[model samples]
Target: MTAHYFIGIKVEKSIRTKLTEWQNVLAKSMNYKDWTSEEDFHITLKFLGGCSDKTIDVYKNKLMNEEWPGAFRIAIGPAGYFGNPKQPRVFYADAEKPKELEVIKLEVEKIGSELGFQTEGRTYRPHVTLAKKNAEGMSPLALESYDLLLDESYSMLIDHFSIFRIHPQQNPKYEAIAHISLNKEE
Candidate 1:
């Protein structure tokens, strides 16, 4: 079987629990084909469709040796959707764009391209996916704007990213194959 991979920021357990609760509430307002499992919540950096183990090894080694921007805090923004609001294709919590995040993303793109990985055509929009697609013949929602789930200002600390392999038959479909820490202190 082919190994499908992506680079992403892992969501902490506490944040996952919180997001899952918020997703539960959102479910009452709108319906979706798939609600993201808490374990699967993440902000994708790049989606690398398929690769050979040898290629994956080379990519992983390069990442380990590459310089990354130091850890920074990324705020969780309000709820947002792609496609129509009432009948959305995807629903997610946005992550504030920090230059540090951009640096890492761009670096990943550069390195990936060097390794013959296809570059993403769309501009990167960091987010933790909540749900996707309208459920089978689901009714359209009013789609009132939803605010950040956390009270006051909230942000997640970023110190690392990883290459995760997809396991479609699993609860947590994405499994981290390699973790690349970003200026992690001892």
Candidate 2:
């Protein structure tokens, strides 16, 4: 079977729990499909379309060898709706440091290209999607606006990175096919 793949930041359990709680509340205020499970939630760094097993292995090696600059603190905020708010589509928590995040994003895209995967050339904006539209009507909400406060801030210690393959099925599963753990003093 063909697999859909992407690169993402695997959040620690502690951070995941906190983000989930906040997401639950925000999801309730919007009309959207609930996430399959908390485990399925992740911040995608790159979308690496489809690839053969050989290609995946080659990219996995590259990712394992690439060094992270250091730990970066992501201050997430600026809640807003995407598409048309009336017939609302996506609700997201915007990433504050677009330039900094783009640096990493570009590197990941480069790796994906090296692996013989299609890399998108579109402008990137880092955001955690809170919700997506469903059959339900738009849930009216007063989206909170702020000067990029830390709705949930954490230092993403870049010791490791992973590549996951997404299954094609209802409530699809994501399998981590490869990872590179950084040797940093924790």
Candidate 3:
């Protein structure tokens, strides 16, 4: 068993399917060491890194017990990358930084800090990673050619969040440790 984990909102199936299709198209133009598995797509809120089972349990309890805002809608789209576009380190689908999403991230951050995890220093830019680790020798992504790909946006509903265990060797590497819905009692 592994201790690596993160807290995130799982991407809905329809969105996953769309992303998978995009991945297929992108693979022809980009080389990445790891293309995120469709089943593993998520909007990460916090990466807790390695933690003991005891810590996970404590973290889980705190999360399940905390109150979250009820389901809200967020816009996701316009394929983008972190770092330089041609040599991008991360390819992603970004979410507009709506207040509803930011509130939950702050709450999760507080929970993580209370458990002795170091606070994340970066600004919260909500995104679902599509791929990581750019491999050598791929054509630069031309903006005009992929207008259909970049011009569109999708609305995603956020009703719940989960703690996921990372299994690097597994095909669909993320496994849910716990799920807490904002609209209902856990």
Candidate 4:
């Protein structure tokens, strides 16, 4: 059976714990219904909607054969939202020094396109989605409050990327299908 898949950089466990703490604080004040589980916290490189096992294997092999980009550091700098503050739809943690992340994403996109996945037309914005609005709009006041809380920074070292299979409408939504180490000598 085909499953929806995406490529992402894993967040370290200590960082995940910190992020979860931040989410818990936000949950107490905001009405956002969907908070990403700590296990699923990652920086996405590409999203491949639905693909067969054969397709996933092909991509995995391609990634394994590709050159590794050396490891880099990333940090949570500030909180931000998609859409206007009055009606914010997504709440996210911005990455500090995202250049390396961008390079990885572009490579992932190129490989995905070569594999016949539709090219993403929108400009890539690298952020870890913290929560999503469910049924109600986030008040501007709440957004402002969260923005203030984001001043404290959280950073981590990135050494690998992975292909994850997502089970639609399922809790603990993502499963790592393949992992590719970065900065490794051949």
Candidate 5:
């Protein structure tokens, strides 16, 4: 069986609406023809895509035993894009000097790799993805006019981390298979 797993710092539910509003503004500014639903939004720490159930359990147990640094706080966005502006591929909520986030990512990558999960080669830049454009490309008008509106920017304390199973073509789709508290004494 194939399961897509990721270690992610979950955005608090209270700020979900604010985050969604930022996305909506960007959609309007960039004139994004395609729509990205709110459920897809999250800042990925590590992507451990497609693994056996045994592997998943091993990772979960490992997480349960480790202690996180602390209640990490992250402020999302003033707006950003990945790839060339003229040929933009992704729009996202940019993290403001996210060194703590980088540290968290490195730790997860190290632990996951030690557990036999091959880590992603790309460098981590924490972000909440807003939209995606296909290989066919976006319109020049859309590309040039893409001004990311981040008026809804806010920060939240990430008290825990979660591992989710991503499945294709299903409602109640992504299930949180595991969670690890950031605070140990709590």
Candidate 6:
């Protein structure tokens, strides 16, 4: 049977904790039904929907053989929304995308396309999704004004990215199917 998969950078625990706290505060004011579990927080590189095991294995082998881009640091930035700011659909904490991150994303997209996965039409905007809009009538203006300030900026050294199988209806929904380490000696 085909399975759903995606590539992403796992957030470090300390950063996840800080993001969870921010989510709790926003939960009080935002009308969002789905709040991403802290353990599932990540910045997606590609969403590969459902595909055969043979296809997944091929992608996995390619990823393992590829030269890893060495570790890079990213800082969590301000809260933001996607779609219309007046009626936003996704609430997220932004990341400062350095050149390293963009290069990695580009590589993933190239590999995925080679494996017959459809190319992503939209430009990549890396963010850690916090919640999704639930209530139909709630105005995005209610969310845009809130300042989500942590005691300090959360930063992480991204050393690896993973292929995750999505369990759409299950708790702890994202299961790591493969982890490719970025330990290439520079």
TM-score for each model: 0.90, 0.76, 0.92, 0.89, 0.81, 0.90
* Best of the two (1, 2) by lDDT: 1
- Give stretches of model 2 more than 4 Å off: 34-36, 98-100, 139-156, 170-172, 182-186
Please, what are the lDDT tens digits per residue for candidate 4 over residues 7-70? 9877788877877877776665566868898988888888899889999999999998888778
On TM-score, the candidate that comes out on top is 3
Say what the RMSD of model 2 is. 3.8
| Model 2 lDDT per residue over 1-186, tens place | 556788876655665565566566655554466453456655678877776777777887787787754455565454556787654577665655544456667888887776666778666767666567654554344445522232546544444657888875645366777875644655
Clash pairs of candidate 5? none
> Which residue ranges in model 4 land beyond 4 Å of their true spot?
137-148
Question: For residues 1-186, could you state the per-residue lDDT of candidate 3 as single tens digits?
Answer: 557999999999998988887787678778899899999999999999998999999999998888788888887786888887676888888877788789889999998999999999998889889988988544236544663765457899888999999988898999998998886533
lDDT, candidate 6, 37-154, per-residue tens: 9999999999999998889899999998988778889987567778766556887888878998898898899999999889999988999998886555443336545543632367
**Worst 10-residue lDDT window, candidate 5:** 134-143
Measured with C-alpha atoms, the lDDT of residue 62 in candidate 2 is 82
Off by over 4 Å in 5: 29-35, 97-99, 134-148, 171-173, 184-186
Where is the poorest 10-residue window by lDDT in model 3?
138-147
How high is the lDDT of residue 135 in model 2?
A: 42
Model 4 CA lDDT for position 5: 95
- The sequence of per-residue lDDT tens digits that candidate 5 reaches over residues 8-99 is 76666666666677665654445553444566567788888888889888888887887666676778776667877654677777765456
Clashes in model 2: which pairs? 159-182
**Candidate 3 clashes between residue pairs 3 or more apart in a chain or in different chains:** none
lDDT of 2: 0.63
For model 1, the stretches where C-alpha displacement exceeds 4 angstroms are 136-153
Clashes of each: 0, 1, 0, 0, 0, 0
**Per-residue accuracy of model 1 over 100-144 as CA lDDT, tens digit each:** 999999999999999999899998899888889767432223334
